[model samples]
Target: MELIRAIQLLKLNAVSTAWVDAVWDCEFTDAEPLDSTVEDEIKEDVKVFKKVYKQLLGFSKEDSTQSVWNVFGENCVSVKSLVAVLACFVLGAKAKSSSVEQRRHSLQAAAVYLLLLRIPGSVANKVFHQILFDSCLDIVLKCWPQSAGKKRKKETLKSSQGDGKSGKRPKPPKKVSEEMVIDEEDDEEEEEEVYFSAQDLLGMREDVCSLIQTLLKLLENFSLRDKPQSADSCVRLFTELTNLEPLVGELSFSEKRDVDKLQSLPELAYHGLWLLCSSSNHGEGNECRRRVFFTDCCTLFLMMRKERAKPCLLPPSQAVCNARDQAILFISQIVDEQTEATLPLLKILIQHICHQIVEKSEYRASGAQAVGRLVTKMPCQNYADFVKWLFNYSLNTRVAFRMFALDVAMVLLAQEEREADATLEPDLASYLSHRFLVRSVVYGRRSDVSPTVRAHAMHCLAQCLELPSHNATKWIHELFSSSSTAGSQTMMETGHSEQTLKRGETAQKTALTFRTIELTKHKSLAVTTRRSTDELPLAAA
Candidate 1:
C-alpha cells in the first residue's frame, strides 16, 4: 500500500506540473506572433502534458483510498488536488487564448475528469463531488456564448452611429448622462470578457456537445444525486442547457456536423430528466425533495417546448421527435398515477403551469390542457381547495391569465357534472352548490375588459349553470337585467352622451348591486361560499 500510494502521488504531481507548463507555454506563445521555434516548443510541452495525463488516467483507475486520505485527511493539506486540476482545465477552456485547439484540449481534459469522478468510490466526500459538478457545469454554461447575435448587432449599430457623428461636435454635460454612460461601459466590459474569437466559435458547437454527453454519462453515478446540493445543481444545469439555442443564426451556418451535434441535445436533455424522475422515486418519503424534482421536471418540459417553438433552419431529427413524445408521455403517466404521495407533485405542476399561463407563453394552450387534465385527476378531498385557489387566480389583473383561469374553471365544472352522482362527496357537492361561485363567473362575463376574456367567462358561466346541482340561472338573469337597467339609467341621467358613461363602468356598478341583492336575498348563498371570501376584495377592486 505504501509503495502504490507513493507511485500515485508522484504521478499526480507530474500531471499537475505538466499542465501548468503547458498552460504557461500557450499563454506566452499566444502573446507574440507564433514563430516556428515558439510553436515547436509549445507543441513539445503539449505532448508532455498529454503523456502525463494518460498515465494519470490509467494508474488512477483503482481506488487510492490511502493516498487520498494522506493528501486530504486531517493534519494534511485540505485542498482537493484532483478537483483543483479539474478546475484548471475548466478555466483553460474559457481562457482568452485565440487557439481553438488549445480550448478543445482543455474541454477534452475536463471531460476526462468527469469520467474519473464517475469511477465508483473514487470520490467519497460529497463536498468534493459538489465541487466537481460545479466545475463541469461552469464549463458548459460559460462556453455557450448566449445571445451573441444580438450583442454583435447592437455593437454594429453603435459603430455606425459613432461613424455618422464623427464630424459633429457631441455635447454631453449632464451628470446623470455621465453616470449612465459609466454604467453602460462597465456592463459592456463585463460582456466583452466572455466574448470568444471567430476561431473558437467555429468549433464550440462540437466541443459543447461532447462535454454535455460526457456529463450525462457521469450523471449515472449515485454520488452526484446522494446529496441534495449536488443533485439540485445537476438539475439546474440540465434545465439551463435545455433553454440554450441549438443554432444561433450568426454563430453557425447550419452545417451537417453542427446539425448532428445539435440533434443530440433534446434527446440528452430528455434522458437527464428521466434519470432525475427515476431517482426521485427512491426518496418517496422526502416530500420536499420530490416537490422540487417535479417542479424541475415541469420546467424542463416547458423549456423543451420553448426550444421547439424556435424556428430552426434544419429540420428536427428523429431523436428530437422521439424525445419530445417520450417526455410528454412521461408527464402524462405522472398525472395519471394520482395517489396520496403524488398529490404534492401535482400541485407543483399546477403552480408551474399557472406561471406559464401568466407569462402568456406560446405553449400555454397545451399547458392549459395539462392543467385541465391534472385537475380532473385530483383527489375529491383536494378538489375544493384547488377550485378555491383557481377562483382567486382568475381574479388576476392580466387578461390572458384570467381567461386561462376561466378555461380551467370550465373544465372543473364539466368534470363535476360528469362525476356527480348519489354518492357525491360532501366537499365537492358544497363547492358546486355555491351560488356566489357561479355568480362570480357571471360577473367576469359582464365586467371583464377584453372580449376574449368575457367570452371565456361566458362559457365558464354556461358550464356552471349546466351543473345539475347549481341553480344559478335566476341569479345570472337578475344580474344581467340589473346591469342593463343600470346602463340605461346612467345614459338617461347623463342625457344620452357617450362620454358620460364608459363601456364597463355601468357593468361594474351593476355587479356590485347584484352582489348586495344576492347576499341580502339569500343568506344561504353566503354560507355556502366557504373559502371563496378571499377573492371578494380582489373582485371588488
Candidate 2:
C-alpha cells in the first residue's frame, strides 16, 4: 500500500528522492518469492502506473491525437520526477538477482515513457532528453562492469588456489571475534559489480539500439509529413549524441571481433545515418544545423567507406552505400538551397567529390554537378574565396584530390564575358585572372608527373583562358609554347594515358582551337542553363 501511494505521488509530480528509493527498496526487497499472486499484484501496479501516466498527459488508451501529444512539453511531470523515475528504472535494470524479463520490462517501459514525452519535440526539448538519453548512455557506460567482475572473480579464485597450494592452514578462529574480521573481508570482496553474461550485454545493446532506432523513426515519420519542429528535438538529441567524442571512441573497439558483440555499434551507426538522411530532406530553415549534420555525415561516410573496403571484413549490408548516397544527395540539396557554402563545407564537398571522380563511383557525376551548381550560384565574394581556398588546398593535398579541385575550379571558370548583368565582382574577376594562377596551371599541364592531373590541369587552364576577364591570347600562346616541356618518353609510349594532349606538338594547337570553338559555341547556351533542385539525380545503382 505504501509503495502504491508513493508511485501515485510520483505520477502527480511529487518528486522526493527518499520516497522513490523507499518504494524501490520495499518492492525489490520483499522476502517472499514472486509467486503467481505477487506477480499478479506487480502486473496490476504496472497497469495502474501506466494509466496514471497516460491520464496526466491528457491521453487515453484509445485516444490518439496531436493535441494530446502537445501536453508532453507542458511540464505536467516535473523534471525532478522524470529524473527520479528514470533513475529508478536504471537501478531496476541493474538490480542484483533481478529476472531478465523484469529488467527488460523496466527498460522498455522507461524507453516508451521517454519517447512519449518527446512527441512534442522541438530543438529546445531538453527537459526529457537530458534525463533519458543521458541515463541510457550512462547504462552503456556501466556495461564494462560485467567483464570487470569476471576478471576480479578469476583473480580472487586464483589467489585462493595459491594459498591452498602453499599448504598454509591457520587455526580456526573464534566465531564472535575473528569471524567478524573474515566476514568484513568477505563482504568487501564479494561481487560489487553487476554480474552479466555475454548474452546479457548483447541483449542490453539490442534494447538500447531498438529504443534509439524507434525514437528516430518516430521523428522521421513526423518529418515526412512536414512536422519539422516536432522532429527537430530528435535531431538535436541525436546530433548531440553523435558529436560526443567519447561515443565514437568507445564504439571503435578492436578488442573483440565477435559479430554479436559489435553488431549494435553498426546498428546505431545505420540508424543515425538514416535519421540524418531524413532530417536533411525535411529541415530547410536551419542551415547551421544542416551544416553540422552534413559535416558529420561526411566524416561518417569516409569512415564507413574505408571500413567496407577492407578485405577482411564486410561492411554492414546495404547500409554503408545507402547512407553514403543519402549523404551526397543531402549535400546536393544544400547546394541548391543555400546561397553559399562555408569554406569548411566547400572543402569537404570538394574532397568527397574528388574521391568519387577518381574512383569512378556512380555518385561521381552527382557530386560534380553539385559542386558546379553551388559555385555558379554563390555570391561573387564567396566564389572568389572558394576558388582561392581550393587553389591552396589542391597544392597541399594529394595529387588525385588536387585534380578534382582543379576540375571544380574549371567548371566555375567555364563562363563567357558578362553582357549587362555583372555577377562576378571586380576584385574577383581580377583574382581569377591572376598571372600566377594561369602560369601554375600552364606549368601543371606541360610537366606534372601524373598524366591524369596534367590532363585535368590542361582542361582547367583552357576554361580559365575562356573567361572574359582572362587574356586568351597570352594563355593560348603559353599552352602552345609549353608543349616541349611535356615528357616525351612517358607521353608517347603510353597509348591510353588519360593525358589530354597527344604526342604530336601540333596536337596542342589543335586542342586549343577545338576548345576555343567549343567555348564560343556553347557560351551563350550555358549562361541560360540553370539546374533546378527537382532535377537533381540520385546516386546511380
TM-score per candidate:
0.54, 0.41
Model 1: per-residue Cα lDDT at residue 533 = 22
TM-score of 2: 0.41
- Per-residue lDDT for 7-72 in model 1, tens only? 243233434444434534453222222234433443444433334345434433345443433434
- Model 2 misplacement above 4 A: 1-83, 90-107, 110-131, 136-291, 294-301, 305-319, 332-381, 397-421, 430-446, 449-541
RMSD to native for every prediction? 12.9, 18.4
RMSD of 1: 12.9
Of the candidates shown, which would achieve the greatest lDDT relative to the real structure? 1
lDDT of 1: 0.47
Error of 1 at 149 (Å): 4.4
Give the distance in Å from residue 410's predicted Cα in candidate 2 to where it truly belongs: 7.5
Candidate 1, after superposition: displacement of residue 419 in Å?
2.4
